[model samples]
Target chain A: MFMAPPATDIAPRDPLLPRIVRLRGKRREIRGVWSLEVVAEEGEPLDFAPGQFSMLTAFGVGEVPVSVSGRTRDGIGLVYTIRAVGAVTAALCGLRTGAPLGLRGPFGAGWPLEEAAAREVTVIAGGLGLAPLRPAIEAVLAAGGRLVLLYGARGPSEILYPADLARWQSARRAQVEVTVDHAGPEWHGHVGVVTRLVPRARFDPDTALALVCGPEIMMRFAVSSLREAGLSDARIFLSMERNMKCAVGFCGHCQFGPHFVCRDGPVLGYDRLAPLLRIEEL
Target chain B: MEIHDLEEVLRGHPFFEGLEPQLARLVRGCARLQRFDPGQRLFREGEPAEHFYVLRRGRVALELSVPGHETLVFQTVDAGEIVGIAALVPPYRSLYDARAVARTVVIAIEARCIRDKCETDPRLGYELMKRLVPVLFQRLRATRLQLLDVYGAPGD
Candidate 1:
């Protein structure tokens, strides 16, 4: 059975220190989302893995652990897709060209891409969950496997990366299916929860690996559907989130039970998480 | 479609997988092929529900209309999906509108005919219920999840 992927160093070298970065570029992704490209002002680009997150600080506003969206290994810099929900995120969204921000460890485990070699890969994302999975999706695409991407959003306007989705659909090896919970008259595409599309995805139950990210409720349904489709807990992986006070394990604020979300996870295999997720209030 | 063809299709449909050949033949008696042009309405809200459909090709959208807004498409049923299942339950009336989103073909089964078959044969009724219940359960579960409003507001 497949085990959880090794975390990219649970604690960064200078765990307490924040590397200052400057926002090199920014773009509005949707109605309330922004994609910001930040580059380290001094050090080398943070070589992060898919599903890892970094502690981002907006001057004196506040700090939040945001997932590394993409460009992790691209040689350029890192990309963080922020939704203006809370204070720290809203501050990060308002930054302009050359604006300064503090960044720390690209922490936690990532999707099991190395072990997934030669296997069919299925990616399922809901809402902003697609951000962290995007790097892995790009890697899987470059590695040339039968890749299927199933994504769901709240509505038509909330759908992210239309250009990228269309481009991925054009790739010979990838099949992309997008659905939404709601759609207006202008949308002629599929309308339903992402899990509904799981039954129609073509993949080998024994050889395919599935990655899922979204709210806990969405992941619960997605995992159940994937299980019904014949995948074992060992073959599925999901990214988890909690209120992480420190980017390191010392704080213990993000502990699920014994493991800390900041260090032990953020990305975890279903086999390790299934039981915890089943508890009444864990 | 020819009775023989319809029986064969029913025998092999995923929804009816493992159904006895005799039962498939009985279902075929109440089944007929239907083709709907793109934008055609299969059934509308408040209409009497006389039949259910198993999509053979193309897609259908389950929609709802608001007083001042454009029709809302809640779900799309693709090939192999069973639609208009409201026909099988009490107060048999379509709750919402189902329209063909593309040139669609389906095996429309007369609900009353099947219900009558189920009445005479308890085992047949049990078997049919065994299959149909799962479909209802799945659709209801999907609806519940969609209603959670996971993305109703901007969230991290």
Candidate 2:
């Protein structure tokens, strides 16, 4: 789903302070996972890049980094898909419609959508990693370009965004292949790591951009698989997650080697991260 | 199916992508089409795995039955993939019960026929082993990944 373009542009607010928002909608995606839609309490729309994240606060429970899953044209509403594994996220997931919460940022760099218009795009996501990549996937689809999606989950029930995946598969330009790590007799889909599907996806490695996000270990394997499939390190992008606070470079809490994940990335190129990714405990 | 058609199917299958025509013909007599209804067992654990199957259509779940708990499906093999690879090695007994999760079709190749052909022509034996080795390695790698529980494991 998409919204209209911004009608009136407002001045950017302080990056540190949180703006209050009201929960407009919520849907349970799976056990312990929720897709939340919120509009600023003052009616200011959230204009964020597809892969950028917001610092969501549950009042007293504290703030956590939640990526923007969807947004409307005028920014009147913002969507986030969150899994309640921690205190803050658990609190956010428990809220009912009209509940008030705090939001900060549309922070961090986003996927390279502008440069990807002419290239074939292949997106590889595992489990909740799809949430951050959802916006970029929608943007690529909206541009009317072809996309190949290879997704892996723990099992059938752990799959996120089933309806959206079906809709994208129905589109002529998108090819979706999903696999699970394991399943019972009831499941007929492919069973294996998401990386196994890389060789099966149809795309020219010479002119393709690969977007990947998921558990750290899964991302590492995906990089290897994409490389084996003939993609260069420069052609791959990943969303790197780390402990983030302050949402700006000043805090240094989200430090990843020399870079700050909050400001320098959450989205980074594999070319630059190759050496770092090889370093243990970096 | 006629010998001509069966050989044609083997030739066209991805598994035989680059096998020599003569080499493919050597094992053609040992091949036949088989189907299993949904929920039917293709092979049971501890049984002699006399034939390895190349799935032409449908899905098969390789499972282990444990007392007092639900069956554990460690892997699900899809169309175009091979199953029952144990037939190629010593103590050729199935390690799991391969059950058809849906109506399925496979090209069953008798292990004895393949082994005999290999003995007669060293090249044919080497070529078949070359292909089967990779499938075995891939399955091993997949099982290792499954044990990691990458999706549900605790980590961002």
Best candidate (score: TM-score)? 1
Tens-digit lDDT track for model 1 on A95-214? 888999998888888899996758989999999999999888888888887799999999989998888889889999888999999887677789999999999899999999999999
**Residue lDDT tens for model 2, A1-282:** 899888877776899999999999899998888989989877866688988999999999999998898874456798999988888988999999999999899899989999777778999999999999988999898898789999999989999999989999898988899998877767778777887788779999999999999998889888988998999999999999998899888988889888999998999999989989888898
lDDT of each: 0.89, 0.88
Docking class of 1: medium
Candidate 2 DockQ vs. native: 0.57
Model 1 chain B TM at 0.95
CAPRI tier of model 2: medium
Clashing pairs in 2: A3-A73, A4-A73, A45-A75
> Which segments of model 1 are wrong by more than 4 Å?
A1-13, A72-74, B154-156
Q: How many collisions between residues are there in candidate 1?
A: 0
lDDT measured at residue B31 in model 1 versus the true structure, 0 to 100:
93
Best by DockQ: 1
